[model samples]
Each structure stands twice: as structure tokens, then as C-alpha cells.
Target: MSSPQPPPHSSPTQGAPPQLEQLFHSYGAKIYGLALRCGLAPKDAEDGVQEVFLKVQRRLGTFRGEAALSTWLYQVALNTLRDHRRRVVRQTRATEMSTLSPQAADPHFVAPGQSPVEQASVEERRQIVRLALDRLPHKFREVLILRELQGLSYRDVARILQIRQGTVESRIYRARERMAKELKKLGVEG
Candidate 1:
């Protein structure tokens, strides 16, 4: 008798084509980094990574090989981030009227004893980088994050963002220039 086969809609098995674990092992860190660059908090980034992987799992069979696998993953991650941002915006708007008035204290101030000096320095630098990133227009920051931080090729970024490769290259250049200027102001050269 022939062995039974799992249904087509079931998750791919270890012996199946296009091993999902292997794909996750190779691209997971890049996906998490991209999620972080998308302005997600650490926990939110983790959630976004999980969400992207779930998406990859569901859609892997339909991948037609027109784009690199990494490019497809990037697109999945970016869409996840966009969804997260929209949810956050909606929640913020819903809570806006009931929130208390803002205090005059610096929002970025970290309380003493909260972290060690070295940790604090790292956190401060992260804050500075995030501030610089926030200053960038969305298009520039997206390209910079995908190209520089995630280490994706310009071609992959263009494919993920649905823009021309030249546009990705130019936007990354301008984004880096703007980030450099902002970093200089923050005493974080380079």
C-alpha cells in the first residue's frame, strides 16, 4: 500500500521542497532588523518578525520565482510594518482626547539606576539614530533601512518597494547624507 500524503494546505514537511526552516534560519535576523528599523519597539519588532514568518509560511507555495526570495521576504516585512503602524495610529487617535496634558520634563530622560553607564550610552546612541531616522521622509528612510541596515541589494530594495533600482540608489544616497547631517548635530559623526 502507498503511504498517505498530507493535504496540500497543510504546512510543508521537513522533507518537502523549499525547506521553511532553512529559509527562516537564513533570513530571520535580516527580517528582525528591518522590523526594528521600521520604528517598532523591541517587543513589537519581535511580534512583527513572527507575523512575517507566518506570512512566509502561508505564501511560500505561491512564490513564482520572479524575484529573489530575500526580496519577497522584505516585501512581507514592510507590509507587516505598515500594518503595525496603522494599528498604532488608530489606537493613538482613539486615546488622544482622554490623555493627560504633557509635562515639561524631557521625554527622553532615563531615570537613574535604570541602566548601567555603558548600556545607557548604547541606548542614547540608539535614540539619536532613531531621531535622525524620524527626520527622514518615509521614502528615504525605507530605502536606507533596507539597503544599509538590512544589507539588501539595491535591486532587491527596488523590487520590494516597487520602485526603479536607480530610485533606490539615489534615495539611499540622499538618506545617508541627511542622516549624516543629523548625526553631526547630535555629536555622532559617521
Candidate 2:
């Protein structure tokens, strides 16, 4: 089978463009998840998603499919979030680091349909995990999030991160090792 051709640049006289909508349908969740994992709060994550697609739409017409669509989408999402992060410094909670507001402690995406007790337990555990993840060094945290959370292949991550595959493998190894230490410090049993 042939590779995907880039989208046409001309203004179609027809209805809404199909390619952007189709791209959103296919990659939207992954983009959102990536942004959230990158440390954007929920609202910022939402805005980042919009910004990512805007960038994606602007250039996807020329995206020659040199890489997989997912790789391109991941690259766009990562760059957009990194750029946004540099410009926006959100205020932290007024409470001490030792204290977490109940609502603030909930994970960005909570699993539904669990019993109330199960939900609370899960939320607490998620909060602990999130705390540990946040405490990790940025490079290690990123590698862990992409490899463990996103489940992207080492090669795919290397392409998106523009690093060597050997570097991806070594970094992922170091990331996991550090994450385990972080979790242990958070009182999680690993």
C-alpha cells in the first residue's frame, strides 16, 4: 500500500475540511493525554490540545508522511506544550506542600463506574503517584511518561524526541529506576 499523501492546500468549495476533523478524531485523545502527562493542569491541557491542533492544521498540508502520523502528532503536541509552558507560570495552591485539597488531589481523568470506596481509594493512590511523578527530574519524568504511560515504542519515542534509539532505551531505563525511587519515597510499595 502507498503512503498517505499530504492534504490539499486549496480552499475547497465544498463543506468543512475532512482531513483536520479526521485527524482530530484519530489523534485527539493521545494529544490530550500527552499534554496532561506533561504537567499541564486540566484547563491548560485543554487549551494545549486546541493549540496543538491549530499547529497541526497549519502544517499537516505539507506533512509529507516522512514519519508516522502519530509521531508527527506527538511532536506537535510536545512542542506546543513546551512552548506554552515557557510562557505561562500558573500560581500554585495556597496550601502548604504537605497538604492537598481534596479536589486538587484527584487525577485529571478519573475512572468511572467504581464504587464510592473504590473511587476514593483509587483517587488517593493516583494522587500519590502523580506527586511522585511530578517530583521526578523533567527528563526522567518525560521518558517515563512516554514509555510507561503512553506505551509508545522505543523507536517511536526516539523519532518524536529526536534522540537516538540507544538513548531512548538508556533514558527509559534510568527513568524507571528514578521513578521507582520516587514512588518509594512517596510511601508507595512499587
Candidate 3:
């Protein structure tokens, strides 16, 4: 699902108390997008978003503003989604969590000016890249999503993943290499 339209007024600053509904309206799409990129099936990603908001509701009082609200939100989402994946995997021992649902394709990933055949080709490649991303290890996927897809800086990614900046850099580099390998296996050029 696409993100909800942002609230009409200015969002609360980082230090302010998180208005749960407002935050959901403001950032739910972002969180959902993150879940999708992290390889959660679309249905699971939706459920994961709900779970993240529920955790936020319970812990909102504890937010100390030590980090940006967005950062804390991402941390909560990643942890919640990770736990959710583990539970699902344990429940269904043979299920593959990395399979991309057909519905999971983001229409926005398609560029505007391409011809129909070109668009189809581009989307095919996008799906292949997403599949490669899904196949990545969680450590690699997390860093790549945060640094590349979410466009966070190395320091911010380090903060979100609670790793050293150097580690984030290294993970991103390795993730890219792994992704290239995966795409090549799928017949996509670098």
C-alpha cells in the first residue's frame, strides 16, 4: 500500500511527544515501505506495521528524545519485523520468507517517460533487484535498505542499527557486492 497523505500542518519536531495517530498517519507508509524492502510479504508487512504502532503506543512514554524520533521509530520497526519473521519461520518451518509477493511490487519504482515495453522491462529488473534484496542476509539487507533505499547517511544508519559507522560502511559495500552477484544470477547486468 502507498503512504497516507501527510498531515496538513507541520509535523512535531524530534523532541516532542509522539502523537500516535499522527505519527502513524505521517510515517506509517515509510515504515511499511521499510518492511517491504526488508523482505516481509505484503500481508506480513501490513501486520508488522500494526505491531510496530502497538509497540509505539506502549512505549511512547519512555521516549527520551536521545535520538531523532524517526530513528527510534525505525529501530522499533526493524526489531518488531525481525521478531515477527522469526515467529513465522518457527511456526512454518518450510516456508521461505524471502519470496516476493506479486502484489509487493511498487508502482512508483517505474519511471515516467518509458515506453510500455521499456516500462515492463524496467519493472522486471526492479523485481529482480528486489528478489536479490530479499535473498540477502538480514544484516546485509538492513544496512542496504537503510543506507540506499531509505537514503540515510552512514552515521544515521549506524545509529539506527546500533553499529559503528565503519561497520555500516563495510556492510553496505558487501551488501552491494552480494546484490550484484544475485542480480547476475538472475541475468540482470550490473
Candidate 4:
């Protein structure tokens, strides 16, 4: 499918929501990935994507085109996920920790070659990092996930999070320091 073009002026040309299928085709995977990286279970991630698109369907006409569509969609997705988190009781860390598996490993961290023992060791480190990340405050975690894990530019993260670029950078720096402290508590050195 061809990409959905932004309207020349703010809002859709005729106050119409873009076709749901077109929007989903263009962004579903990215939204799902963001949900998963934010610590949602696979099923929850899928559901979150649906919820985000539902919002888009309902409110796309309200979008002013001041930001890129992806940015606006991300803002909606984060708000949806935040609301969901507040509505649902959280799982204990032990239960949540067990949910991480090899399939969920970040591709960016994969090594081309490793002995079985080394692979197991690497996986252990990843689990530790996940635990450390989960311990971070919401604001810090959001920046790290967007900037470091999702590999978004500082500018894009500021737009999505609705914060200044300097705020994003400072939060990331603080997040790294806190992550280091958490890892140290778990006996992993930086």
C-alpha cells in the first residue's frame, strides 16, 4: 500500500480519519514493538496495538499535523498503555522476570558467535539488565527505551514524550547512572 500522505494543512483535508487499514499496515508492527519493549506481555502488546489504532480511528480528525503521524501515534499509544497500567494490577517482579525468554532478546545485542556457556552467560546478563530497567522510574525508563533501546533520535523522543530535547538527554544520563547502580547491586559491572 502507498503511504498515507499528510494533509497539506492541519487536520485531514475533510475531517476524515485516514483509512484504518492503511494506518495499521504502516505502523502496527512498530507500535507492537514499542508495547513489548515497555514490558508488556506478547498478548498484551497485541491488545495495546489494537487499542492504539482504535484511538487513532476515533481521534485522527483531531490530529493537527503539528507532529509527524508516527509521533502522534506514539503519544496515543503511550497514553493508552499508561492508562492500562494504572487500571490493571501489576505482576510481581519474580513472575515478570520469568516472562523474559531467548526469543525476546534484543537483536542489537546478539553476538555472531558464542559457545553455549557464553550464550547462557550473555542471557543472564540480559535478564539482569531487564530487572534493572524495570526498577527505573517511569520517566527515566521512557527515555532510555525510546533513545537507547528503540534507537530513536533525541529529537524524535522529545516529540513523542512531549519534553524538551535537553530533558531527554538529562533523563537518559540519569537513567544510565541508575541502571549502573542497579546492575552493581546484582553483581554485574559496567
Candidate 2, overall lDDT?
A: 0.77
lDDT agreement of model 4 with the native: 0.78
- What are the models' TM-scores? 0.66, 0.73, 0.76, 0.78
- Give one digit per residue, the lDDT tens place, for model 3 in 1-190: 9989866546555333447878998999999988776766788888889899999888888889999999898889889988986665565566754444534666756566878899887777767877787788989988888888888899889888998999988889999999889989989878
**Could you arrange the candidates by lDDT from highest to lowest?**
3, 4, 2, 1
Off by over 4 Å in 4: 1-18, 85-103, 106-112
How do the residues 169-188 of candidate 4 rate in per-residue lDDT, one tens digit apiece?
88899989998999899899
lDDT of 1 by residue, 141-173 (tens): 888878777777888888999999988888888
Q: Which ten residues in a row have the lowest lDDT in candidate 3?
A: 9-18
Going through the candidates in order, what is the number of backbone clashes in each? Answer: 0, 0, 0, 0
Cα deviation of 166, candidate 2, in Å? 1.0
Q: What is the lDDT of residue 99 in candidate 4?
A: 41
- TM-score ranking from best candidate downward: 4, 3, 2, 1
Candidate that would win on lDDT: 3
